[model samples]
Target: MPNSPSAKKALRKSQKRRLVNRSNRSALRTNLKKARVAVEGQPSEAADDVKTAMRHLDISAGRGLIHKNKAARLKSRLAKKLNAALTES
Candidate 1:
């Protein structure tokens, strides 16, 4: 229970922000899953999947949902997988 007016307002804002953040996080996960599926189904599409994953990673990092270094590392791993698939093919 927020007794103060400002606290009530903050609570309301927090709820809204939570909803938005949840959607963004869900979207990020969805994109990652799509990329993984694409890579598994068609190795040739790994490059494109990596591109999409990297774009989503950048967006997540820019919005402060994920750390820049974490984003970079994820992108690096995805890129590496993509490159390996390409080389193997």
Candidate 2:
């Protein structure tokens, strides 16, 4: 429904960006889930998984895909979970 040529081009560009962003967001979520699972099920590997998840979160925050504060909060929660798991065993 873009009337002008420029508008059409912009729409196309937005669509491409949407797809890329979606993929990145999905990957981030997957990493977070994996980290949570590792923390709960395999404390031995939780540290590495948490590290990878934190790195992904930092990258996503830097790229403006997620808010910096939210990323920090997630990192904090994950760290807490990892620490708790470690302390238990």
Best by TM-score: 2
Which tens-of-lDDT digit does each residue in 1-89 have in candidate 2?
A: 99999999999999999999999999999999999999999997788999999999999999999999999999999999999999999
Which candidate's lDDT is highest? 2
Give the Cα lDDT of each candidate: 0.85, 0.97
Q: Candidate 1: misplaced stretches above 4 Å? A: none
Kindly list the per-residue Cα lDDT of model 1 for residues 1-89, writing each as its tens digit.
99999999999999999999899989988888888777767879666766888899999999999899998998887777777777777
List of clashing residue pairs for candidate 2? none
lDDT, residue 15, candidate 1: 99
* TM-scores vs. true structure, each candidate: 0.91, 0.96
CA deviation > 4 Å runs, candidate 2 = none
- Residue 88 miss distance in model 1 (angstroms): 0.9
